[model samples]
Target: MSDNVLNQLRNKRNRPTVEPRQDALVPKVQPEPQTEEQNSPQETSPVPATDNPTATPADTIAELQAELEKYPETRRHSAIVLEKDLDQELTRFCKDRGITVEVFLEAAWTFANADNALLEKITTEAKRRYDQRKRVGQIKRLITMLSNSAK
Candidate 1:
């Protein structure tokens, strides 16, 4: 029995252990959705960063809505999950200005998508946030492992 137990322990120690694949550690990247320009045949210059600096939010929203109507049903509906507090604040802000949250988000996307500088800023911020989240997750996993071992 002692020899059998020793053999079992030795076999377990000598067995090849599989480390996680490098690609598994990395996040899976989804292909970027094609933009309007990509879908169109003719190449056009990007929209000017700002057509009118003094344009009010309402004017911008109205213009965006009109522009959207030009295309024949190209828009697709998507849902986003926001924190409760942020959602409440956004709802109240839009309500105070007499604009729907959907319009506000659409206008923001249009403005951000048009400008190169804004796009760069967004990319940088997104990367920073992603890295921060990854680090937090790693730390949490380490703490969990340590606690389990202690138990």
Candidate 2:
């Protein structure tokens, strides 16, 4: 086996075990019950009144437009880091169709969100990949243990 393959196996064997979240396992604290005195109504400050009592529909639209201006239209980019071969395959896939990887991902997202069957198919594919990876990990662990014992 190559040095790289041996290094990878060693890294997996020495990987740290993740502990379960203590906060998640702990029970949530319950709020104390309010007594009659605590629940009793008390004098409170008056709430602020709307700035415009008789705002027109056009004014409301203008206000919404102004609010939207605060959050200017911007394109957000996300990335997925794939292994070397997978990365090359995805790049080739997009290149064959004369589209960028980002465009391909966006189109796939839109199609999956719109079509239930496509979404289900993608989910199944993901599950299958996860199961395959899990099995591979188990085999790697077994190989690591066997190698260590032989040493």
**TM match of model 1 to true structure:** 0.37
What's the count of clashing pairs in each model shown?
Answer: 0, 0
The number of residue pairs in model 1 that clash at the backbone is: 0
Give the 10-residue window scoring lowest on summed lDDT in candidate 1.
22-31
Best by lDDT: 1
What value does the lDDT take at residue 16 in candidate 2? 80
lDDT, residue 28, candidate 1:
34
Residues 37-135, model 2: lDDT tens digits: 797775653543235645555665686688799984858766675668988999999999999888788788988999999899999998998888889
Q: How well is each residue in 1-151 modelled by candidate 1, as lDDT tens digits?
A: 9999999999989978898664322233346678877876755545444465456666667877898899867456778655579899999999999998888988888998999899899889879978887898899999999999999
- The segments of candidate 2 whose C-alpha lies over 4 angstroms from its true place after superposition are 1-87, 96-103
Query: Which is the leading candidate under TM-score?
Result: 2
Worst 10 residues of 2 by lDDT: 21-30
For candidate 2, give the lDDT.
0.76
Candidate 2, 33: how far from true, in Å? 80
